[model samples]
Every structure is written in C-alpha cells, then in structure tokens.
Target: MQIRKKIYWSLCVLLLAACRQSPPPSRPNPVLQLREMGQLATTEYELSKVVRARDEATWYKIGERRMLVSCRARIKAGIDLSQIRDIDIQAQGDKISIKLPAPQILTFSIPPENIRVVYSDVGLFRTPFSQAETNAIMQQAEKQIRRQADSLNMLQKAQEGAAVFVRNFFEQAGYKEVTITYRYQENAS
Candidate 1:
C-alpha cells in the first residue's frame, strides 16, 4: 500500500506538469523588419540626352573645337527604410499604419557603354576633343539629369511603388488592413 501511494502521487505530478500551458510565441515587430530592409529601390529611370561642348576660336589658336555626346543616365529612386522611427509605425489588432520618409534618388549612373561621340568638328588649326574634355561634358549631362528628376516624376512613381509593397508585405504578415503615408519634404530627389 505504501508503494502504491507513492506511485499514484508521482503519476499525478507528471500529468499536471504535462498539462501546464507554455507561454504563447511572441510575434516579431514589423517596424523592425522594415528598418532592416534599408534602402528600398522602387523605381528606375533611363534618360538619354545629347550634350554639347564648344571651345571658341582664340587669337593664338586660330580655330574652334566642338563635340556632341549622346549619353544615357540611369536613376534609381526609393524610400530609405532605415530612416523609419519607432513612431512611424502603429499597430492596432489586425490593422497597421506606417508613415514612410519622402522618396529620393538612391543612385545615379551613366554607363560607359551607353555613351557615344555622336558628332565632332575641329578647324585645321584647333586641337581635337580629348578624352578628358569628353568626360567633363558627360559629367555636365549627369548633373542636368539630376536637376530634371522632379520633372520626370521619379519620386512620385517611387512613392507609389513603395506604398504597394508595404500593403502587400503587411497583408502577408497577417495584417487585415494597412495604411501607408509619406512625410512631407521641402525638396525631393
């Protein structure tokens, strides 16, 4: 009877331990995930322009030099996810709201393969356009593209793309409704 009582108590203890509930799994914060995404490239713009440079005739040089280059510039625009602050995200049950930073140009490049000397003219006494001169003209074109980014609507399209991405991401993360908005900016790239 003594052995029986000991065995019965041990069985009761084992059953209670097995039936105890474990803590529910914690959900990861979505805002942290977004910040970890860093720069999100949402749109790319390919622009082609013809740039011209001219050297007027000097009394000593006796002639003029002119060159025209056709170059293609690529611009990437997106929102910087790492800029998201804690206050930028709000979660309430199945709904989530996010305030993203204004979109900007993340990268600009003029690939060498996309540049060509479309035209050149040099007087008999003038020196031809050198590689250095051509490079300078290409740089000028790049700056012009940067200045015209706003007119091309690059940032606006980037913002729209980012909104779509956020909505899809949250919906897949079990959020029933997602609202995305951007902060105001004095100037955008």
Candidate 2:
C-alpha cells in the first residue's frame, strides 16, 4: 500500500509540472517602438495666402506691372519620433515617463493645382508677367505661409495632440501612469 501511495504522489507531481504554462513572449521595447514610428503627424491644416506685387514705373522702367496670386498650402505638424532616445523613455512598474522633442511643421506643400491667379494687371507699356515671374511670386507666398505657422497655433495644437497620443499609447501598453514632456527646440515651427 505504501508503494502504491508513493507512485500516485509522484505521478501527480509529474503531471503538475508538465501542465505548468510557459512564460509569455517578451514584448518589443517601447522606446524602440516609438523611434521606429519616425515622425508622428498629429495635425493637418489647409491654408491659403494671397500675395500681391507691384513694380512701380521707375525712371528706367517703362510702365508699372502688378500681379496678385493666391496659393493654398497644406501643413502637417508633429513630433519627430526618430529623435527619441532610449534615455528619453523610462518605465518603472506600471508608470512611464517620456521626453519628446518639441513639435514642428513636418510637411508644407503648395500643390500646383491649388494655386490660382486671383487677379493680374499689366500696364499697356509693360509686358505681361512671365511664367518665371509667376513662379517667383508663388515661392514668396510659400515662404509667407511657413512664417505664419507659428501665429496659426499649429505647433501648440500638435504638441497637445502628441501628448494625448503618447499617453494613450502607454496606457494601452499596460502603463497606469504616463507622463510626457517636451524638449524645447529653437526654430521649431
């Protein structure tokens, strides 16, 4: 009877060990995941700018030439995740802290189809504005759109959106508390 009891106990132990579950697979590092995201564009805006240029009739010039051009630009702003370093992310238990680069305009484009010649005036003595001249004016308009990005609060909105996204991402990754901060950048608009 003792031998039978010993055999049963051994079999029970062996079964328990064999049925034990294996450890789950390790997950990718959160910091590496963020870095792989490249740039996270959070906000997009379609903006329009009108530019007018007048070449006054000077002593050397025959007559005045004035042109008005309008252009629509698409701007995308976000944090550059590629700039995220390993040290920028810290995880302890269920809490995580991350430092991100300041948001900036990621893309600014003026599609040719979106440009319009709103108005054009050419003096009788002055030749009509050349295609090259029109292109130069459009370039100037693009620059103006870039400069206005700050005033339009695009960076601010992008920063807010990035913070929300990071927070939600960490939370979904099982982090209970997520703290996000930004590193200041010069000319980050």
Candidate 3:
C-alpha cells in the first residue's frame, strides 16, 4: 500500500510539471522585446482646420451641378514603431542612438456624430449633402492636412519626441548620454 501511494504521488507531480507553461523565447534585440516602445515613443501633432470643399459637374451648360460642404477636420501625424527594425538601433558604452522612422498621418477622423455642417449649397435639382458626401469631403480635407504638414513642422516635432523618448530609455538603462536620430525610408508616404 505504501509503495502504491508513493507511485501515485510521483505521477501527480510529473503530470503537474508537464502541464506547466514555458516562458516565451527572448529575441536578440532588447528594444524589440520592449513591445510597442516605438509606438509609445511617437510624437503626435494635431491640426484642426475648417475646409471648404466644392465639386462641380458642369459641362457645356448641360445640367450643371455643384455641391459644397464646409467641415472641420482634426488630423494627427506621428510615427508608428511597429515598423521598427533592428538595424535602426545602436548602442555603445555610455552612449546609445536610435534611428526612428519618418512621420506620417496616423489618424484622419471626422466624427459623424459631431460633424457640424456649418454650410452647404447644392445646385438646382440636386439633393442635399448625405453622409456619404460628407465622408468624401472629409477625404479631401485629409489631403489638405497633408499639404500643410510641412508648414506645420510636424517632422521636426516627431523627431524631437523620438529623441526624448529614446534618451529617457537609455538613461534608465544606465547610460550617461544618449543621442537619437531619424532616418526617413525611401518613398515613405
């Protein structure tokens, strides 16, 4: 009976050990292991503008039609760290550097619930602006925001934010000084 009890307890212990989950494998780069650090390190520049979008379908005075909708759009530009590469990061004794990706439009949203149709004008025999029309106008507004990105200095702001984030991270890692830089990918749209 004693021998049987000992065997049963040993089997239970082995079964429990087999059922335990193993730890996830670690990657080569410590920064990559930080999961979403790149995202956390992004700088978002917000721009709000009131856009006047007009569309005309006039040809030879044959049933001319024009539509207009004025809307306010809030655009956000930032970098996404989920696209980070190992080569973009480098570290040495008491010094570290990271090359962040270029900044781009992160979010372009016109809240339907809060879309304030300040003004609208439709041509004769034309229907009023619908939700779909509003959406299309919002797309144009997004383009307008993109056209103004350079003027707003979004790229510089993004770079500053990336540098600050990386600097802090390295400092926490026991580094005396850190330098952060950015490398825009070719055709980074």
Candidate 4:
C-alpha cells in the first residue's frame, strides 16, 4: 500500500507538470515594401602623388603618381514618405549605406493671397463677408499649395544629394566602376 501510494503521487505530479501550458511563440518582424528603379552609371577619378629619393650620394629623386578610377551607379526607387521613420548613412572606403530618415509630423499656416475662392453667384450674390472669413479661406488654400511645393522641393533635394553621394563614394573608394542601388522601403506602423 505504501509503495502504491508513492507511485500514485509521483504519477499525479508528472501529469500536472506535463499539462502545464507553455508561453506563446514570438512574432516575426514586419516586412517592409521596397521599390528600386533603374541604375545610373558614371566614372570617377582620384590622383595620388608620392616622392622617393635614391642613394644619398647619387642625389637621385623620383616622383610616383597614381590615378584611382571608379564609377558611380545609382538605382532609383520610390517609397512612401509617410512610412519612412528614419534615415541613416554609413560610408566606408568603397561602400555606402543609406537609410530613411525618421518620420516627422509637420504643420504650417497658409497666407490669404494664395487662396482662391469661387462662388456660384459672383457679382452681387457673393456674400459680402467679413475680412476674417476671406483671410481664413485664402490662408487654407495657400497652405495646401505651399505644402505641395515643399514636398516637391524635398524630393528634388534628395535625388540631387543621392547622386552626389554616389559620385563621392566611388571617387574615394578608388574603384573604376562603382554601382549604387537605391532602395526604398516602407515601415510598418
């Protein structure tokens, strides 16, 4: 009886341990949407000069010059600007690393002159409203236009900057043909 009781208790303990639930599996990182365009190719050149002297008595000296040639290639791509959460760049002798900048929420006001308001009745039916209403409408329109302009400007700047960066990277790396692939990825919220 004693042995049977011990065995029963052991079995109960083992069953309880086996029945205990385990923690849930972890989730994988979200996938990002990336777009890559065509490639732009260019050549880069770098020159270095070194001077050397021969035997002291001979007084002979020689100058050595080296030309490092490289090419810069760019791949264009589109990305959701809103999803971009961060931008970073890492450059080595012959390699470059780029990342999107952190997402920023910006707000601005518009001016009255830029706003255009059209009314069904223009001549006399047009409500002779107070200056404040007119100003507000104009300001809103101006703001929208300005925002669009700003977005375009930013895109242009980014493209220009990317080109320059690729050129410089190739020149510094002493590579004759350097290819850069621009990739855009959207971050998950």
Candidates arranged by TM-score, highest first:
1, 2, 3, 4
Clashing residue pairs in candidate 2 are none
User: 14 in model 3: Cα distance from truth in Å?
Assistant: 84
Q: Write the per-residue lDDT of candidate 2 for residues 23-57, one digit (tens) a residue.
A: 99999776653433589999999987788888784
Q: Could you estimate the TM-score for every candidate?
A: 0.72, 0.69, 0.54, 0.27
TM-score of 4: 0.27
RMSD after Cα superposition, model 3: 18.8
| Alpha-carbon local distance difference test for all models | 0.87, 0.87, 0.66, 0.41
Off by over 4 Å in 1: 1-37, 185-189
Model 4 Cα lDDT, one tens digit per residue, 1-189: 999999999999999889967899999998768855333322211212121212123233333222211212222222333432344445666555555432222323232232333332222322343457444444444444444444444444444455565557656867544444344333432
For model 3, the local distance difference test gives 0.66
Instruction: Please give the RMSD of candidate 1 to the true structure.
Output: 25.5
Which runs in model 3 stand beyond 4 Å of their true positions?
A: 1-41, 53-72, 80-90, 121-126, 183-189
Best prediction by TM-score: 1
For model 3, where is the 10-residue window of minimal lDDT? Answer: 60-69
Query: Tens-digit lDDT track for model 1 on 1-189?
Result: 999999999999999889967899999776653433589999988998888888884667778888889988888999999999998899999999998999888989889999999899998987888899888878888888778866988889999999999899999999999999887742242
In every candidate, how many clashes are there?
0, 0, 0, 13
Q: Pairing residues by index, what is the TM-score of model 3?
A: 0.54
Which one wins by TM-score: 2 or 4?
2
